[model samples]
Target: MKDNASLLRRKDAATPRGVGVMAPFFVSRAENAELWDVEGRRFIDFAGGIAVLNTGHRHPKVVAAVKAQLDAFTHSAYQVVPYEGYVALAERLNRLTPGAFPKKTTFFSTGAEAIENAVKIARAATGRSGVIAFSGAFHGRTMMGMALTGKVVPYKTGFGPFPPEVYHVPFPTALHGVSVEDTLKALQLLFKADIEPKRVAAILIEPVQGEGGFYVAPPELMRALRRLCDEHGILLIADEIQTGFARTGKWFAMDHHEVAPDLMTTAKSLAGGFPLSAVTGRAEVMDAPAPGGLGGTYAGNPMSIAAAHAVLDVIEEEGLVQRANQLGERMRGRLEALKTRVPQMAEVRGLGAMLAVEFCAPGGHTPDPDFTRAVQARALERGLMLLTCGVYANVLRFLFPLTIPEPVFAEGLSLLESALTG
Candidate 1:
């Protein structure tokens, strides 16, 4: 059998350095919330493949659906032949996503593709070129995605000459000392100086910032953006790529707010580990783009569509939405209790199962990325996997599968506490 060390040597030579990997070991197989490396070392998964396995790795239903699809047909180029599963999944999303108005849905291969196409649809519908995003928000890594992303270091560093007509404003975060009023004022100034509201095609935001540190977008901010979009004829786009599929205790993060977005990008856990994404929007807005203008060769792969259908079925039948809330509350309580012992724990915040804990210098507000890295390292040493986020790399976010067994979840949490306290 090929050992992990040998595989690592091979990987170093075969893969480019641009694709950064977290875990040192090579995954041999995974199931639900656990995985085994090439050496057969078992570890509890807390990252959930960066929020791509909300239903867990190789969910039985998802696997069964894909296997069934494989027997029928595999790739027919959705744009050419098209299939019923694609349309069925789209129909499910239209009804499932938040919004009382008539909606339409289209598929894509990745979250970034959904964002790019949403931009096109918004521009076509509004006849505008300007798009407004917020700081500490993560859209994707594509050219247009990079332009809209708020972070600069890794995502936007070497990749320059990004798409133009994209502007950014501060996102409200009490920990960062930015307030809603401050964000609103910055938008006004942006309109007065950089781009007018009339020229804006859309204002894109993550209902819960993913790569930007899992900060939940304030409800007041959502309400203000809705009003501003209404006054300016700009479409509101919600990037729910990482927060979709009951991860945030809801089907979509936007569902937690009273107002609904004009267009929403959903992926990651949407297809239960399958490479599938979608953009759902108001019917008229979605119809703006000419039929031939949208879609890709593998936009809605039959296998992915079939898996998505099973994913939706599992979510409904198993009540993962409610499970998320239950798990989040339990985890939050444990973390809160531990905060008394660990002075570096700055904050514990998130909605439902989509929670994160920020670390800071002892008794100080300064971020402590060193300590965060230490905790992650310690967890990995003890057979647990964790992921870090935040602009400062000082936040540890939890993305455990909602369907994790109680005994396994408890074991993972115990390991996590030891790592944090040690």
Candidate 2:
């Protein structure tokens, strides 16, 4: 087996510097909430593949489902030959996602594709071209996705000349100075100066900002958006890519709010590590994009479709939604206790198991990305893997699998305590 040092040399030589890697070692094997490096070092997986393994790595049911699909045949191209798994999954999502109105669901290969197509559908349905996104929101990396994303560095640095009529307003967060009224004022200003409300197609937002920070959207803000959309005939598109599938203690984070979005984009943990995303919405809006306007060569592969079905089954059978709530309370309590000792810890926020801790300079709210890096490094040395995010890069987000064993979870928390204190 190749040692991590030797593999690093090869990786640096063969890959571009733009593709950043967090861990120094390469993975050889992984199970639920754990991984083994090529050199035989074991790690407690807290990253969860960036919120793509909420069901955990290689879940036996998911693996068995994929194996069964492989035995049957892999790809038939749902649009070409079509398969039952694809249709069945769509039916399930339509029934599962928020909104009691008649809904329709379509599959895609990635979150960006789903977001892009949702925009197309919204534009087609409303006969408008403008879209409104929020500050510190992460949609995706594709052209349209980046256009919708609120971050500047790394993501939108040199990718200028993005799609026009995409505007951004502040999202309410106490960590930042932005408030719900401020958010509304910005939107009103956009309508008065940049784009007219009538020309707006959709207003997209994450129920919980992912890469920006694990900031949950206030219920008041959600209701305001719904009201604005209703008043203007604009569709409210909930980008639940990272917050879906019980990550926020519910199937979809929007479920926490009483308002129902016209469209919802979902991916990441949808297929239990397999690449599959979806756009589920009111039937009329979904049908706006004519047949040929949607679909991809590998949209809804049978293997991924099979895995998704099993993932849904596991979520219900394991009672993961409730598990998420329990895990969130425990983690938040532990982290809150650490804050008494770790002066740099600014805030602990999120819903359910989707939580994050932000760091700042001691006795001040100034972001401390350096200290965040130190904490992550210390955690890695102790055999724990953690991920850092937020626009300021001073927040450490937790995305461990809901299925993590009790002892393993406790051990990870102990390691985290050491990381924060040491």
Candidate 3:
């Protein structure tokens, strides 16, 4: 009834201006890592809906789950009338997340909701009010999440007086010349100058920072945080919203570290393509929320839970974790080789399929956000979709679907390289 541009204009007037849309290409449908816009144009989706399509769009198992669920039931929220799929999904998450101790999981509708509830549980359990967040972490878009996030341009700009008692400390980045010990010192200083150790409720961080950058947190840093939490009685939270599922070549990114966290937040690929988020953690910490204290009207919709169950099945049945490793390795290797041709490409780093190529001015570390934007635009024009992030906005992240055909992945990478070089 209406053209894409006209429809988008109507939507813009109705919806708030707070949302930042990527190209105006309204996707009609997608399968695996490929998307077809309403105009009937095909584009290789390197963005993957900002890493939410790890299983790829409309994966067969995930699609089947949704279809089957549509025939049975869609709602009757878990809080109102609990269902089997919800409990089963929670049990699976508990077993899957990294931790030896008993764990419990609760679901939500989004990553921000999961993160918010996790903080509430930690605060209630520890009887503390302060939370320590890292400088480059992207928690979510909620008020509390915005407070926890480390960026300022779009995510945190004009968003002030965020949730209280949230303090920030530097996050070590090798490319930025910050060390793990330096981060530790900043935390120590924060405790002494701003928030006291006794008042701290949690220290939440992204295992692999998303939105901010595709920076993988080092194992040493993870282990150090675990130790610090142990000594300070503060709960350590691993926000694996982006790195969860099979994106990081592991079921959970924390699996890369020797230590475990008191709480973990997951979303994005949890329910295949459905919207679902969860907080799984130590049994005791989870129990902090009283029976009536936690839960919402649409907290764990049966349809979404069913889809999550199917997502897990697909991940295992397809061996997507291993697939992620293979795919990520291939992508990174190609980008590394291209570095010689594109002198502006400063570093290529990431874990598994959550890889990124950071760019800078040629021969210098001066971030080249303009070049990054140009490359992304060029890629889009050439029928490849890409996304950018980082505090300086100079990193191009690749989140191709694990189900993407090898040839298709190669084709997208080649186009991307040409864009960078051109």
Candidate 4:
């Protein structure tokens, strides 16, 4: 078997530098919340494959579902032959997602596709082209996704001139001094100075900014956006790509809000580890797209659809939504108690298991990405895998599996404490 070093050298030689890898080691195999490297060393997974493993790796239900799907047929492009699993999954999402009106859903192969399609549907439905997004929001890597994404260093560095007519406003962050009123004011200014409200097709937002940092969108901000959308005939799109499934202690983050979105994008943990994304929205809006206007060749692959069905079964049967709250409460309690000793731990925020701790310089608000990196390094040294996010790269977000075992979860937290205070 090739060791990690040898495989890494091969990888570097074969793959482009743009595809970043976090861990030094390469995995040989993974189970629920744990993995062994090519060198046969074990590590506890807290990153959850960047929030793609809410039900954990190789979950029996998901695995079995995929196996069964394999024994059946693999693909005859969804748009070609079509499949019942795709329609069934769509039906489930339509019923599960927060909305009372008649809804329709379309599947895609990735979150970026879902986002791009959502924008297309909105434009077709509203007969408008301008769209609005927020700062610190991460949509995806495609042209439109990159256009809508707020951060620029890595995602949008050399990738312009991107799709035009995409506008951005500051998202509210109380810790960073940007308020809800400030964001609303920026939107108003954008409509006045940039694009008028009548030309805007949609206002896209992440209920909780994902790659930007795990800053939960304030309820006030959500309500205000809904009102603005309603007044202007703009469709409100909630990008629940990272915060979907049971990560936020809710089926969807929008479930926590009083108002519902006109359309929603979901991916990441939607099909356990499989590559599947979906755009679910109002039936009328979805129908705006002419026949054959949407869908991809691999959009709603049978294997991924089956896995998604099993994932839903696991979440319901295992009670992962409530489990998320339980895990988040315990993790928050631990971080809150450790704050006294770890002065650099500036803020502990997130909803349910979708939590993050932002680090800052001692006794000050300046971001300390160095300290954040140090904590992550120490955690990895102790076999606990972690991931960092935020525009400043100063926040450590936790995406642990909701199905993690008690003993393993406790051990991971213990290792995390040592990493923070050590």
After best superposition, candidate 2 residue 336: deviation in angstroms? 0.6
Name model 3 segments beyond 4 Å from true.
1-3
Q: Model 3 over residues 296-389: C-alpha lDDT tens digits?
A: 8888888888888888898899899999999988888888888889999999988999899899999988899999999999999999999999
The residue pairs that clash in candidate 4, if any, are none
lDDT of each: 0.94, 0.94, 0.89, 0.96
Cα lDDT of model 1 by residue, 195-279, tens digit: 9899999999999889898888999999999999999999999999999999988888898999999999999999999999999
Q: TM-score for each prediction?
A: 0.99, 0.99, 0.98, 0.99
Cα lDDT tens digits, model 4, 241-273, are 999998999999999999999999999999999
RMSD of each: 0.7, 0.7, 1.2, 0.7
Q: In every candidate, how many clashes are there? A: 0, 1, 1, 0
The residue-by-residue lDDT of candidate 2 on 1-422, one tens digit each, is 58999999999999998788999999999999999999999999999999999999999999999999999999988788998889999999999999989999999999999999999999999999999998888888888989999988778888888988899999888876778899999999999999999999999999999999898999999999999999989999999999999999998899999999999999999999999999999999999988789999999989999999999999999999999999999999999998889999999999999999999998888999999999999999999999999898999999999999999999999999999999
| Residue 95 accuracy (lDDT) in model 3 | 92
TM-score of the candidate numbered 1?
Answer: 0.99
